[model samples]
Target: MTAPIYVPFQHCDALRTLAVPYGCGIDTVGVDPASAAPAGIPEPTLTPGRYLQEIRSAIRAMRALHDLLPPTA
Candidate 1:
């Protein structure tokens, strides 16, 4: 099987920043989800289900932002 793509921490941070309007928390955004469970990252103080819900909410927000932005020239 092919190896999983590993993103650098900086890139992960950038993604989080872009995804913020989607409802991602400042602290959670800093975390690399791929690395979180493996690196013994602590569970988000929030419930797992709630975290996922917020992520979904954030994605919707991002989509709205995309729709509102003018298309590139």
Candidate 2:
């Protein structure tokens, strides 16, 4: 993985990697789903190359659209 450019901010006392440059968006999720990575369960893993490619693809798609999804009324 590329070196993290942003120092991780403590969230609930856990250090989480920052995806600033590549983060397309963020949404709240259930606690169980969020714990998978921080807990190191390792059931699902992505090779760095493939992961970066997917991230680039996602950012491109989002940029092409030119707007994020609207909030629910």
Candidate 3:
């Protein structure tokens, strides 16, 4: 058995063409919370309710930003 290969998200498009022939799988990673801390800034602590509220607020902001972008093909 072979282990899966980790390919960067940006390079996945190129790898797609070779993945099947090589009989290997490619995976991409998402956010690494351990490294998400801002430089020179301390992380904040939040209760469960506050955490959920913050997450919801972020989603709303992202949706608003996405709506501002022009339509694409």
Q: Find the candidate with the highest lDDT and give its number.
A: 1
> Per-residue lDDT of 1-73 in model 1, one digit per residue for the tens?
1111222333344344565446554322244454556566564556678657656655665566557556998
lDDT of each residue in 1-73, candidate 3, tens digit only: 1111212322343244445346566554544433665687664554688657656655655565456556899
Determine the C-alpha RMSD for candidate 1 after optimal superposition of all C-alphas: 10.0
- TM-score of every prediction relative to native: 0.39, 0.30, 0.39
RMSD of 3: 12.3
Q: Which ranges of candidate 1 are over 4 A from the true structure? A: 1-45
Q: Which candidate model has the greater TM-score, 2 or 3?
A: 3
Which digits, one per residue and each the tens of the lDDT, describe model 2 over residues 1-73? 1112111212211211223435434432333333434575553444688567656655555453333334567
The residue-level lDDT of candidate 3 at 6 comes to 16
Higher-lDDT candidate among 1 and 2? 1
Q: Which ten residues in a row have the lowest lDDT in candidate 3?
A: 1-10
Best to worst by TM-score, what's the order? Answer: 3, 1, 2
